[model samples]
Target: MKATVDPGRCQGHARCWDISPEVFDLDEEGHGTVLVAEVPAEHEEAALRAAQNCPERAITVA
Candidate 1:
C-alpha cells in the first residue's frame, strides 16, 4: 500500500500520527506528513486506519 498526506487539507490533529506513527509524522506546525514514499507492508493496515480516522480526510492510502 501507498499512503500520502495533503498538507493543504491537514489540520494538525495528529490523529494519523496517533494511529500509525511508523507511516506518518508531524511537521513543525503539527500537521500530518508522510514519513515514507511507500507504505511498508506491515504498516498498511495501520496506514489505512489513519487515513480513515483523519478528521480532515487529508490522508490518502492506495
Candidate 2:
C-alpha cells in the first residue's frame, strides 16, 4: 500500500506520528511527513490507522 499526505490539508495534529512514529515523521513546524511512501506488509494496519486518525484528513492510503 502507498500513503500520501497533502501538505495543504495537514494541520499537524500528529495523529499519524502517534499511531506510527516509524512510518510518520513530524517537521520542526509540526507538519507530518510520510517517512515511507509505501507501507510494508507488517505496517499496513498501523499506516491505515494513522491515516484514519488524521483529523484533517490529509493522509490518503491506497
Candidate 3:
C-alpha cells in the first residue's frame, strides 16, 4: 500500500500523525506529510488508519 497527503486540504489537525506517526509525519505547522512513498506490509494497517483518522480527509491510501 501507498499513502499520500494533500497539502492543500490539510489544516494541521495532526490526527493522521497521531494515529500513525510511523507512516505519517508532521511539518512545523502540524500538517501531515507522507513518510514513505510505498508503505511496507507491516505498516499498511497503520497507514490506512492514519488516512481514515485524518479529519481533513487529506490523506489518500491505496
Q: Model 1: per-residue lDDT, tens digit, 1-62?
A: 78988889999999999999999999899999999988989999999999999998999999
Clashes of each: 0, 0, 0
- Give the poorly placed runs of model 1, Cα more than 4 Å off: none
TM per prediction: 0.96, 0.92, 0.91
Best by TM-score: 1
Worst 10 residues of 1 by lDDT: 1-10
What lDDT is obtained when candidate 1 is compared to the true structure? Answer: 0.93
User: What are the candidates' C-alpha RMSDs?
Assistant: 0.6, 0.8, 0.9
Residue 60 of model 1 has an lDDT of 93
> Which sections of candidate 3 miss by over 4 Å?
none
lDDT of 3 by residue, 1-62 (tens): 88999999999998888888888899988888988878899889988888888888899999
- lDDT digits (tens) for residues 1-62 of candidate 2: 88888999999999999998878899899999989867888888998999988999999989
> By TM-score, highest first, what's the ranking?
1, 2, 3
